[model samples]
Each structure stands twice: as structure tokens, then as C-alpha cells.
Target: MGDTGLKRHGRDRRPGGNDVARLAGVSQKTVSRVFNNEPNVTTDTRERVLAAAQQLGYRPNGAARALLTGRTYRLGVVALGTSHFGPSSLLVALERAARSINYALSIANSFEDDPSGLAEAVDNLLAQGVDAIILSEPVDDGEEPLVVDVPVLTLGAAPVVHAPTVLSVRAAEGGDAAAAATRHLLDLGHRTVHHIAGPQRWWAARERLENWRHTLVAAGADVPEAAEGDWTAARGYEIGKVLARDPGVTAIFAANDEMAIGAIHALHEAGRPVPGEVSVVGFDDIPVAAHVWPPLTTVSSDNAELASVGLNYLVDYLNQPDSPPAPPPKHVHNLVIRDSTAHPPATEKGDTRA
Candidate 1:
């Protein structure tokens, strides 16, 4: 029996070669070849080494192996701590993908206000020996950290750039979906669609606002003052009340589903008929979107796929550090047209037909 003190936290930290040699009655060097996947190890030797590893819990340290080979099989992710829809979803997806590829992920939460914080976080990840880093948030105007010792990749929340970055479903695409929602309202002949946008600091908010403006401009409709909501139903309700009182504001495009739900409640309390007096369209087809009284007509963002793509990209970089950065993946968004949107009221009276 090996000494318990040899392991830390009760984990078997016994050297694989020593355990393999003991079980096979061979030299430790022969065992090393088998464990390293090196050539020249006989099948019988390999089986003995494998058996010894299983008995001793002598798993190879991937990080140590990389250090020996000058490659680390670890990736770092920079995500925001805020509970916004896109960032949070991306983080969860990344965790799943990283595990699937036999790579570990080191995540760092960043703040939007201080863009420099990203570089600082990158430094921290580097210190932790991460092989590559993915920026899930936007890059601020600072000295670009593109050519770090390790490769860097980017997802949404950052502007599109032709570089080593890989983008997976960006806010701009989300904006396009928002535009589709606005156009759905326009097709119904609503004069204009009012918008309750999220906080400006988020890339999703900026992109959605831009799409809303672009859609209105194309239609030659007056874009009403957009109230800012913080991805919360409460803020949505507060902003919805203001839009509800306006006779011209017949339709609304909320940046997220939470806000959309709040907007629905606000409109209901103000006695405005949905799809009759005022139509509402929202982004992000969250679970609750389908449950609302008149289900929300919203765009579905595939965060799971997005996260998986990013994680795969980083893992590949770890395998082939010299592999020229992969091009950003094209993200597809589909609009789910539910009952939340319809013809805006011709006159600000009441028409409650489903």
C-alpha cells in the first residue's frame, strides 16, 4: 500500500510510471513509453501499464503533459457577471463544450465600464497557464491584445473584426431578428413601433437599438423615444406604462423576453388590448415567452450552439497552436412568430380579438 500522504485532498497522485513498473515488474522507462503513448511499447506491456494505472488511480496530468510538450490543453473564457440573457447563456454553454472535449475551462467575469479590465483578466488567465482565451464580451478601445503569446478568440458583445477572432451568434444578428419583429408589426400597418431597449452598455442592447432604428428609417416612420430597461420585467413594466399612454406608440419591441413579459403586464393594467390597441414583439425566446397570455413573438438565440462552437475553437487552438485562427462561425437566428404581435390599432380605442 502507498502512503496516504502522497496524495493531496485524498486524490491518488502516485506517479504512473512507478505504479506501472511495480505492477509489470519492468523498468519505469518502459512504463513511461506506454503512458506517454510513445512508440516501442509492446501490447503486453501496454496492458500491464493500463491495468496498473487503473489500480493505482495513476491518471496522467494533462497539464503536466502539455508542459513537457510545451502545450497546455486549457482554455480561458471571459464572461460578464451580470445576469443578462446572452452572456449568461454563453457561459453555461462553454462549460458543457469544454468538458466534452476533455479540456478544462478557466472563466473570468469582466465589467463593461472598464474595458481595460479585459486585458487584466487575460493576464490572470495567462498566469493560470491557460492555452487560449475567448472574449465573450466586447473589446473596449485600448491596445488590442490579439497577438498574445497564446491565441485569442472573440464571440458576441464585440464588434466584428477581420482577425484571428471567431464570432458565434453576435448581437448584430440578434438586432436583425429584432428588425424582423419590427417589420412584422409594420406589415400589419402600424404607424411605428416603440422600443423598450436594454442598458446601453451591453452589446446586445446597442445592436437591437440599431436594428430598431434602421427598420423604422427604411419604413419612413417616426421612431419614438426609446426607454431603457435593464433586462428585467420591472423595468419593462415601468417603461411600458409610458409607451402605453402614447396614442402613436401602437407597437413595442422589447430587447429581451423578461422585459417583454413586464411590458405585457403594464399594457394589461393600462387596459390596452394586445394585438389590437398595442402590439408587442420581444427578442430571446425564453421559456416564459410561450406561456404569456398572448405568446410573445420573439427571436430565438441558440446560445448552446454558440457556446459549443467557441469551446471547440479554443480546444482546436490548444491542439494546434500554430493552426491559423479559425474564421468566425456564422450564426443562424430564426424568428418564432407567436401571438404577441399583430395589427396596431387604427384608432386608440379597444379591440380585444385574439
Candidate 2:
């Protein structure tokens, strides 16, 4: 860790575990334990070991660790490459969760236009020798399901790909959330609710639309034709202009916060007072939802918990690749009611205020 060890290892040699162990006054095995993130090391010992390693400019030998563990400890993800809040949040959650267990993450992105992107991404992860592959943030991909040799885990949807070893831990998606949002509108005395749904190809999008429709049907409410959107505010605004033209549209459920915000803007421009006439609900409870002029009421799921649970399932699959797909982790959906939603406007029946 000091100039002595540096001189001993020679100028050309790299600092390794021994130097860190000597500097930290711990055994070589302890240094290995600390770097490998195994249990039995105290907090002080771990910090001392890390500090010593840092001072010596020592980095763990990735190749050596892989050889010793017989696993790369890497989880590769094929995620939808967009700035959409939901997907972006899930990606960040996955990174944080992976690091907590001392694992590495590799991500491949597939755009909506790239149908064959998933296949190529699977091959790329396989080539990288990842322990498992995760399919996150489903998109409208037309490519045939992929088949790979390693374990595969998919979040928020079905197994878009097939693998000999498949975990397929279902991540919580839209069904419950959509139903909650739709029911919230119905409970407010809106005879019928309109929907602004995300594109149908993605499983998450389809789930939200299907659930919203089912909820309306279950309530014996009028089911209006839904407007499909591209998960973009611009698209939401475009669709909103059309919906705003109809006086019959008393309540609206947008698939995401961005769309809801866009719809709100369009409604305002059209001289429509939100909640006074058209009550709006959105999904994903994004940060801006609360700050908007009329605080948006929306549904939220824990992306961080979803990501952590998905990785743990992947780990289980790695340990037992042949086990049947496990029951989905328990997920909770929260509906935050705010000023944006209220009872429908007074008619001959009676006026019901917020």
C-alpha cells in the first residue's frame, strides 16, 4: 500500500490483494472476502480494507474473480431505449439493485422501430457471458421470440423471449393500476370515462388499455373508443385536441403522467376547466404530476422494488435453472388523489362537488 510494497512489486507490477491485506492489517483471505462481498466481515473491517485498497490504487481483478466464481455475476438487460419516465426509472433501479449485491450490469436498448433488436441483444449478452438476461420495458417488437442457452428474466410482462433456462419473474405492470385509476373516475359519478392508452404492441401498454376497458365494462359504463398514443406528450396533446372537442368526454384516464399533462394543457387551451368538466387521471405518478397547476391524480408502482425483486429471481434461476417460474413477488399499487379529479359537472340530477 506504501512505496515499500510498490518498490517490492516493482514499477511494472500492479497492486493486488496482498498489498491491500498488508496495509489493512487483515489476512489475504479477508481481503478476498471483502472484495468478493462475502459475509463474516465486520463494517469497520470492510471500510478499512476498501480504504487501504483505494490508497494503493488497487482494483479487483475482474477476470480472476470470474474464473474463481465460475460466474460472471453480471445481469444483462434489453430495455426500451426511451426517455419515458417509467422505463428510465426502472433502468436506474436495476443499476442500483445490481450494485447492492456487488454484481455488474450491462444494458442493451431496443427502439420501437427495431423489431429485430431483441434477438441481436440476446446474442450480444450471451457473447458477454452474463449469468442471466433481463427483458425490461416492453416495446412493440415484431421479432419472433428469442431462444437462448442461459436463464432469462422478464419484467412487467410475459417472456418475450424463450430460453432453455427461464425464470420469467413477472414484474408488476398496469392491470391493477389501470383498474384502480378507472374505478376512481367511475366512483366520482362519471357515467363513462375516456381513455388515452399507450401503443398496443407493448405488453404494459396493452395491459393498461385492456384493464381500463374491462373496468368500464364491469361497472356497466359506456365504453368510448380509446385514443392510442406513443408514450409522448406531443402525441397526447394531439389526441387531447380531439377528445376536448366532445362534450361527452367527462372523465379521462391517460396511460402515463406525460400524456395526462399534455391532455391537461390541451384542455386548458380549449377553454375546458379540469375537474369542473373533464376530470383527468394518469399513471406512473411522475415528479411533475404533483407540481402541475391542477395536481395530477395518478397510479404509482415501486420500480426500485420491482428491479430488486427481478434480480433476486434471476439469482434464483442461476442457482436452480430448472425450477418452474416462481410466483410473482407481491406488488402494491398506490393511487394518489389530488385536485385534478372530481365529480362530474352538475346536470339535472344534482351537483356533486369535490
Candidate 3:
């Protein structure tokens, strides 16, 4: 007496390849060919086999299939594992892109800043037999380069990795965005712009900082020392206090929207009216950016589109390894103007005031 009042057999009876073959009126090998995506089978035959498998709720054994095909059909993602807008948004986009291509995603997070942490994370993904890897939000830790045997795709700047095939796709150039924001402020009559930068270890942060400095120098504006923030509102608030007190500081650009929001709070508390006495701008037009008081002026990029392009390149390379590699395309960043920035106040003066 089985639990369901059905007779138990020596061999467990679940949906299997032979069951699908019988339902589809095809041979078991034909069913295997369909599951493996092998060619030479007629289109009608493939359709019938798939329909039968669906009807019988039959799923191919992935482990057994991988053993036979020498490919796992799985993609691995290594991320910073933070709730920050950029990394989190890229992770979601990667998952969606992988699913759309019939590939499963194995995500691993590196919480520590050390290179060993990333190495360990990559090893974990490799152990799962991912066909390719996507490194998201890579940072420099001043350690030896990482080596991987499979194709590696980087979301932003390329990390030091010794792999046969390395591809990089950026959502938006951070340097360009920073330059645009800084120029916008200068055009609005701010003598110089104060910067609140993200951690220097991350490449994106360095790019933004470098461009901001370059833009000011090119325009012959006095480049003030940039304040560093740890990509958090709390850190932004702390740093913002210092800048808020400097009455000469007429314009500020925070690395990202969260920090910008924090700066605004600090300014309000210090009785400095945004866009009135002081102007503020930020990077990453996150969902809440437009809803914040005075509506944040920030740099916006299409993270999902970037993810799709990177994933498609990886898939294409995997499918056609012998094809000549195509040069990566350039991405443009857009600046969204809002209520947070304006010309300097009438009483404000440039180097003379500070």
C-alpha cells in the first residue's frame, strides 16, 4: 500500500525521456536530441517532442545532460552584494537577461574589500560549472590578478583577470557623466564645484572623480579637494556637514543620488537653500531621485539595456567561439536636469569669497 494507494515498483516512476518519446510517437534518442538542441531533426518532430514533454511535466536531468554535452548552459554572476542602486539594479537586469536566453544564473557575492574575497567568490561560481562569468562592480584591491578559464564579461571597468576571452560593457561612462554635471554647474555661473566621491577602490568612483577634476582644470576653475563618502546617506550627511559650513561652496556634486539626498538634508539643516544659496547634483537617477525635495538633478543610464548587451555578447561568443571578436560599443550617459541646481546667489563670489 503506497501513500497514494498506488502500487510501488522496484524502480521509481517519474516523468522520463521514454515517457516523452512514447507520448510524442518518437524514439527516445529523438527526444534526447530535442532536449540537447541538436540539429537534423525535423521542425515538426522537435515541436511534438517539446509539447509532449510539457504535457507530461518532464524535465531533462540537467546534471546528466551536462555530463553528455560538456556544457552547463549556466551563467555565473559575481557582484558586490550591496543594496546600492547601481549594483542591485545591474544584478536584477542580469538575471532577467539570462532567463530570457534559457540560461540559469548562479549569483555569488563578495562582501569583503580584499582580492582574496573575490577570488573565493569566483571559485565558488566555478565549482558550480557555470559556462561563463559576469563580474559586476569590480574593484581594485592591489593584489595579483584573477585567472579564469571561461569567458568573462565585465559590467563596468575590466578587472585584472587572465582569461582567454574577456569582454567589457559599460552601462554609462562615469567620467563623461561627471564632466557633464560639472560643466552644467560652471555654465550656471558657479565658480567651482565641490565633489562628494564614492570609495576610491571602485573604478566607477575613480572615473567620476578624475573627470570632475579634469573638467574644472580645463575650464580654469579652482579645483577644491573632493570629500569621500562610502556610498551611503550617513556618510554623505557627515561629509555634507563640512561642505555646508563653507559659505563659499556654491555648487556640489555627490557621486550618487543617495549621497546627494543626504547632502540636501545637511544643507537644509544648515539653512542653506538648495539652488538658492547652493546647488546640488548627483549621479544615477534612481527611482526616488525625481521624488526627492526639489527633485534631484542627476546622471541617468539604462542599466537593463547595458545588461542585455553584455549578456548577449557572452552568449554569442559561447555559441561561436571561432568568430572574430567585435569591438565593444561605447555607451552615452544622460544628465537629467531638475530643480536642485541653479545659478549662484547674487552675493556669492568666486575665489575671493572662499
Top-scoring candidate (TM-score)? 2
Clashing pairs for model 3 are none
lDDT of each: 0.73, 0.83, 0.84
What pairs collide in candidate 1?
Answer: none
Q: After superposition, how far is residue 281 of candidate 2 from its true place, in Å?
A: 1.2
Candidate 2 matches the true fold with a TM-score of 0.83
Q: What local lDDT score does residue 170 receive in model 1, on the 0 to 100 scale?
A: 50
Which regions of candidate 2 deviate over 4 angstroms? 1-59, 169-175, 319-326, 348-354
Runs in model 3 deviating more than 4 A are 1-61, 113-115, 171-175, 348-354
List, residue by residue over 1-354, the lDDT tens digit for candidate 3.
112221237554677888888888899999987775554689999989888877777788878778977889898898886899998998998899777655789999977366566777789999999998899887775668888988898876656898889988754444378899999999998889999999988878987898899999999999999988899988888888899999899999999999999999999999999978899999989999999998999998778787888887787777667886677755677899999999888783343332
Please provide, for model 1 over 187-292, each residue's C-alpha lDDT reduced to its tens digit, 9 standing for 90 to 100.
8878788899988866668878988899999999998888888889999999988877876677888998899889999888999878767888888788778998
Cα RMSD (Å) per model? 6.8, 3.6, 5.7
How does each model score on TM-score?
0.74, 0.83, 0.81
Q: What is the C-alpha lDDT profile of model 2 across 187-287, one tens digit per residue?
A: 99888889999988778889889889999999999899999998788988898899999988889999998999899989988988897888999999898
Q: Rank the candidates by lDDT, best first.
A: 3, 2, 1
Worst 10 residues of 3 by lDDT: 1-10
**How many backbone collisions does model 3 have?**
0
